[model samples]
Target chain A: MRAVGAEEVAPTSHPWEIQADGLVVRVGGRRGRNAVNELTLRLGRGVHGLLGPNGAGKTTLIRTLATVQKPSAGSLSLLGTPLGRATGLRPLRRRLGYLPQHFGYYKRFTVREFVEYLAWLKEMPPEAIPGAVQRALEKVGLADRADDRLKTLSGGMVRRAGIAQAIVNDPEVLLLDEPTVGLDPAQRLSFRELVAELGQQACVLISTHLVEDVAAACTDVVLVSEGSLVFQGTPAELAAAGTTDHVGDSPIERGYTALLSAGPGRSGW
Target chain B: MTAHHPGEQLLRQYVRGDDVPADQLWAVEAHLESCAPCRGRLAPDPIAEQVWADLAPVLDRTPQMPPARSWLRHVSHWVSPVAGPWLAMILLVTAVAVALDQAGSVARGQISLVLLVAPVLPVLGVAASWGRAMDPAHELTAATPRAGLPLVFRRTVAVLAVVVPGLLVASQLTGASLTQWMLPCLAFTTCTLALGGLIGITRAAITLIAGWAAGIVLPTIALSRTSVALDVAATPVWAAVLAAGLIVIAVRFRTQSRSS
Candidate 1:
């Protein structure tokens, strides 16, 4: 007879860390048109880049997965628990990390303090918090500026600090929306390396318009257009889907434009 | 004295994150900068690797680490940034109202200025406590598990803790009985939160404040008599409103939690 084991049920080994089935999220309160229209996705422990054009509901989808907004219809489950139910949310929340597209920081807070405060909110263990905060800051290359106030930092540095806070808990499900907006090329390169490392253990989902960032760091790419899945495949497959007829600088971008044009509801007002 | 090399022993200590003498650390890092083979000889330690990836462990050990966050910092985390100034403003308003009453600026022979504004003061404070405009991080705060009611209640209580004390002082000084405005003050606060569930806390607070100004304050000032809303005999009515507001709040939270 086999005894129950925590290892067997640990989230890393879980088949899919995030599962969504025909999910719908309405924006602008009730009676609003769906921002994320019937988004269906399954993600496991790996880096999956979410690529979409502007106003394609990428932020709304990321917000829903972060458990910030409730699904107006259908279902969403993270690390195996259904998001709709009223049970065990606190526990689930403790294991999640999110960086909003426009995360605000107290001007007076040092970079370390900001991450530490978020780690506390994420309900990290008190004893583990200090070390976890350190590791996260180091991971994002912000350890040198840890003691500096947020107001003193540059825009790119602030974005890196935001990334540190998001990873402080070593979260099972990490959601980042438009995380590379202010990053310089050198900063973006290191950010890609950090993301590649994080994807090895956790389900790291980054929603962005930068196809190059995803192609460099992501193991899998999921494309959405107008709140619907246009393509879900590896970077190689995405590159293979495109032809010279498509307008782009690279194979991946050409593929993205190709599939997006071919997908239903393309450029329809 | 190996000027070009600090030797393998000192390099090992540095790589293992063991405390090497400061002089040797400087010397070895300097030597490794110019000596390629010496740098290649060091074994990797995971902790030391992270600290010395691009630079050396010296960068991690900054002499002046910022002081640890204090207990007061923790308190402020739950409270909104606007709570302090908003509460101060409430006190200043209360003080002004008290002065108005002392200066014989009563709305009527029976109506005190302190009693007139006390009920709406907390309502205004509630708005400051929860307004997205007031909090720059509202989007991030709303996304957290502790975001919805728990966080809202924390800010609400912080507002009340300040406003209630100020109102008590104002009532005592103005010779207005606490019973006249105390229930209405709390009732308006709860009602703001209740209606907040439908059309945001800030909007609800504004609507309630506007309604109070238009419906009660205007009529009371125009007629030079106490409105029925502020009379002591309407304690039961205020009590009912407070209870109804609390019930709606509870129901709203329940539905919100289940859906979210």
Candidate 2:
């Protein structure tokens, strides 16, 4: 639950890595309802936690950030490059690392091979791959199991492998959706440490339902409901929104319930 | 210990952005990890500073052997493990068709079952090579920067690599001219990809397979003769189809990949 002030981190010369302005993403069909509705956010270098209930457009927003899906309306930019332009997004994609909520893997690939393949996809220099793969595996504590095939590993280890692939390229923008789903408590602690370390340079956005995770790791928390952002601020600010009547085991959870009940239209810090 | 470390000059060269050899750079990095004083001694240039910032976290670790040998690595990129059984099945089907032709049971007049089935073999292989339903890693693969045409083409080449040689051998055994099936085979494969960019590969392959079976294979069997499309005289037409398919695939690839 430690928060690093933006002033403590070196200011980035590049524009916000993720800037979404009045972004609207509709799913189903042409007249489909909004999956992400008029959401706007600007993020730089830090760890951000996105919290919401099921069907709150967290995954939709993450997919859009990953550039896997186009917004039905509004504008988005990654690394200062505007999306939906005639110019290709490869340059921005090359700098992105994404782990989807339902991460898929080639079961036959060894952990090392999986990470290396992702690095290649990211267009890392060929010579730098071996070293980068090794470092990424080490960061995720999967170095010992680097040679093990993905199918042979436990679920938690596989999740760790997903994280390893995400970081293999040392991405400038990292989007991880529900990264701690299968991890044990100890692994979650280590994952938090790793996220803290990555936040020093990269803009890290993690989408999860675990309020404790948001409380413990996030420098800032964004709360969204019904496809729109309701709150954004430091974890303490979120906790302050909690009322004595709110039901939760902890301050962050109380804060979560408080804001979620209060719903959208609350001003962000 | 000597005051001047052996890596000092190399580290200086590294900082100056001189072309330091990989091993020398590695050595200097390894030495600097434990040698804080030497690290401080190296004055920072912006380029070198950024390089170090990026590399310092990742380079000090012990290097592991690359996950696969170069050839295996290339093969893995081209096809998945599930592709092994699928390729084997394609070969087996070709062998069965060759056997039936040799036995004279499935042969209708001059038409061989092998010839009838040859054009779609690579299509089946290409279908198996990619698809959201077929590939367990499709989601992860799709999210990658290189996931579109390049990947699709790589898998297609891999399929052709296996299916083409098998069909060539089958054709030799059946005494069928290579042009009778090769051109159409190439055409069908390209068309699968060309259509795949729009409708998806599995659907394209299935549609092509169903169309060929109904339009050519069934009619040729019913008439006890080869279809005109598979005739040696149709080589030029097949060639034209192949060319068009390639053009479509190229255009579609450029548009789809650019949009993605």
Model 1 per-residue lDDT tens digits across residues B176-243 = 77878889999999999999888889899889999999999888888888888787898999999999
**Model 2: runs farther than 4 Å from truth?**
A1-14, A29-32, A265-269, B1-71, B107-110, B253-260
Best candidate, TM-score-wise? 2
lDDT of 1 at A253: 95
Among these predictions, the greatest DockQ belongs to 2
Q: For model 2, what is the error of residue A127's alpha carbon versus the real structure, in angstroms, after optimal superposition?
A: 1.3
Model 1: runs farther than 4 Å from truth? A1-14, A29-31, A265-269, B1-67, B106-110, B250-260
TM-score for each of the candidates: 0.81, 0.83
Candidate 2 chain A weakest lDDT stretch, 10 residues: A1-10
lDDT accuracy of residue A23 in candidate 1: 87
DockQ (Cα-based) for each candidate: 0.22, 0.33
Kindly list the per-residue Cα lDDT of model 1 for residues A214-254, writing each as its tens digit: 89989999998878877888999999888999989999999
Q: Docking category for candidate 1?
A: incorrect
